[model samples]
Target: MNFIKTPTLLKNKSLSLLITARVSSNFAYQMLTVAIGWQMYSLTHSAFYLGLIGLVQFLPMLVLSLFVGHISDRYDRRKIVSISQLVQGICIALLAFGNYNGWITKESFLIMVFFIALAHSFEGPPMQALLPNIVERKIFPKASALVSSASQFAVIVGPGFAGILYSFGASLIYSITAGLLILASVLIIQIHVNKEERKPDPVNLKSFFAGITFIKSRPIILGAISLDLFAVLFGGATALLPIYASSILKIGSFGLGVLRSAPAVGALLMSALLTRKPLKRNVGKIMFTAVVCFGLSTIIFAISKSVIVSFLALFVLGASDVISVVIRSTLVQLETPDNMRGRVSSVNMIFIGTSNQLGEFESGITASLLGTVPAALLGGVGTILVVLIWRKLFSSLFTVDSFEGSKN
Candidate 1:
């Protein structure tokens, strides 16, 4: 269990392959997200349509995350991930085709998004489950950090590059993204995971219910995951960035790229900061403070009209958010037993993924109903409230000893 002693994960050829594949896929996916938002907004000039795009992506993830988590635990994670990537590649190619043919309609593009979400529903849980097996458990923290950092780095690179390509045209961006997916799938074929054999759970309604039941039984994990869900669901402002770029900030696609990349920059920097010396004592307290700061930054961001001020706010928000991410991921990995990492990660995905995609949808809907400023401001307020409520309701689970003391 002293997995840190082994430098194998960092030095292992297979691990290197997996990391490369993940990074490439993530870069393309991040590019696609910003490209889609810009495309939709340019086509319709409405926040509701923006919300609809989020909804299209979120609905499948919400509906299928649990089942996919179960499948990941029960079957071949490598195959699952590879197949999902293949499907996603096809979906992106179709979008590219439509764009090239000048036959793209909003409804048709949204349907493509729906298929992409479906592929993601299967893709995420299995990919996360595959990680613990690829590296030793002791190295899990660093591995997770590297993975998170790699993905965020993609965010930094992808949208920034995409904005420039987007100027050339949406079709070009789609073509590039599709090419990345194909490359990712090829890389996945080179990596391997040792699948755990388990007896199939009963194929019935009870099995589905059991997944939720197991999650409810773990208060620390449940509390941490739920607190994040509520806090993020209410406060995430990513969905409204398009509006901010065009109308409020009076900036173009380049400004939009900077705005989108801001959080990833903060997160990447924090990840590097933590790697120098990992988070030790009072992790729970740190996580709480981070969430509070995330809310505060969002509030500040909502009120800021200046691009420079908003970027600063986003940086803080990203920094705070990554603190919580590292803590929460560590907590889940430490607390969950080995037999159930996939299921647990899948369950975790339900909270985390939904909070992100659905949170985007919520922001979009609220922005459509209320004005964008009010919508964002209200989310910030709600995030603060969630933190306070979680502190009270789950007080006991939110504290941690210093890393040295706990390790003993």
Candidate 2:
């Protein structure tokens, strides 16, 4: 595979810096997520609290995303991303202190969760919007591939690393995460965002409504969004992993890390393939097939009793889901005007954020009630049904083609 070509975006230096920054920052972030989950479970011993952790983190992102998107359009994206990352670093460091001192009561943890979530709320929209400015339009697919692969690599490393560190001490794991985040912030500061003419301030409610209105009007974008939402919302099996790791799989926290990382492993492998030779043709059909594969894998995972079997199922789920994600993300970026990227991305954030986090909550609550197997099976079934419904509802989008040739 030739990895030395000049990308469509900025010169190689800028893209390299941005990619490194994102990878380092995400590794830290993912590690913290796993550490926090294990810590919370140890503290509360309730699946409801586990679900609540996801909810609390997601709530701020859902609530303030519109404003964040607006800010990204009005000002310097680099600055916004830098500041938010710095704040997040502090937030992670604070958690470490709390862990070390044993001052991490439930309320304190919840408060920290809310604050970190607020940081993410501000950070996500701007960071996503910044991508188009960093890379050339022609190489957007390649850029997306690199980003996706980096994230999956983080997923592969972070959870497993956290599990090992956590065995020694949660505080140690948190401290390491904090250090990595600070390093990531430093790396982000080195990035050079391609400047563009600024848009008018986002002052009016009508404009806010317009952003929402625009997304709703574009059936291709809307369909892509809904497809992800329904599929992830219904097919998500992450929350039940703890149950599997503990009970059925007969492995503890260490095994849980391996299980959780399985999907990222699959994604990382597929992303490598896409990076070398991009999946450009039949994007729409591929997306549907990928979602179907994800659903089937989830169902298989739900029924599997063996740890190895469950991991294989999750690997398939992860690999297939990446195909869907790449296609949806490429479609959104390609179709959206540069000015509207932030707003559209915010809407995108809302759908995905709500689906995954709320889906985690749903899984947790349902598992608490219906049992893990039933919850997993039902979520998979729901995903399959939603795909069928969406295929009929948004049939026009099923023929989505490369932006180079086709007119939307």
Candidate 3:
């Protein structure tokens, strides 16, 4: 909370508005995820369907990443984001209507999320590209920290908020999320930034592929990006949390909410610490170390039968993940030029999108085959293996000592 009040950051009205808008939308998105996961699980009682939700969301992300990036670069980034949020809010409201009337079949539920994903794909890239322009270079790190903390705050409470509302009804959760998202849209539309209108690249094959080419040319960026993709692809234990809450932990929806939020609690705390004492050295090493810690924490969570132990492991995993996230994100932003930011962010989004949505599919398939516990265990072991392989292959990324280190 205190982090939001940092004097340098709040001086910019646009930054302030953007952060607040992001907080509202992110909170809605998090709560929406909880609602979707739980509602689908409750109705179908199938891990496969739960995973299907991720696939549905991923399709738009995969198909539209390039176009979204190009559009972000060409258009008013703030406008792109505002419209995206509005679209999602409208779809969520529809979801609420369908849900309240008991008309949302599993198939319908899947379709709704697909539309939400379409809006989401549009939202992520431009929103990311806009931040750098809204504030000074020197204050970007602090700004980024505050943004991350806002997201972490949403993470910490969003699911829990959903859970409490869910006790009233699933429709209540969707309805509230819809209202929040619409509020976010309205708030953000009023923001103003200092970016100059540049003549964007032409619409051609080369323009479409620019982001890919830039990332491929930088080993550090390539390694950092790829490492996150594969690691999360293998280690997306969160996808199976509903099953854990219902089958293993014998918990109700409220308890599931707590488990869902445990990692974010750790993430929020660690983000605050890093904000106060920004990383000054061993930057790359710390990122790798954090990844390793994340993997180990997953393992601990996988093995733990007790609720408290599982919660603690998830907390540590979330904490460790933020360290890697802050480093990788800073590296990506600082290294790339402003004009290229939108495209590069999109490329990053694709990897992140794949790792998350596809990872859910993988988790579901594996859980079905291996059982929930074994699926989780295998993911933890697999994450460690990725770190081991990535550390050797991406040695340049591993050894770098600063956020602005050479891309070579």
lDDT of 2 by residue, 256-332 (tens): 78887999999988887777678767777778889989999999999999888999999999999898888888888
lDDT of 1 by residue, 260-296 (tens): 8999899888876765457878887888999999999
TM-score of 3: 0.97
RMSD of 2: 1.9
lDDT of 3 by residue, 288-316 (tens): 88888888888888878899999999999
Best by TM-score: 3
lDDT (CA) per prediction:
0.82, 0.80, 0.86
**TM-score for each prediction?**
0.94, 0.95, 0.97
Off by over 4 Å in 3: 3-6
| Total residue pair clashes for candidate 1 | 0
Candidate 1 segments whose C-alpha is farther than 4 A from its true place: 1-7, 194-199, 402-408
Q: What is the lDDT of residue 197 in candidate 1?
A: 57
Lowest summed lDDT over 10 consecutive residues: which window, candidate 2?
A: 1-10
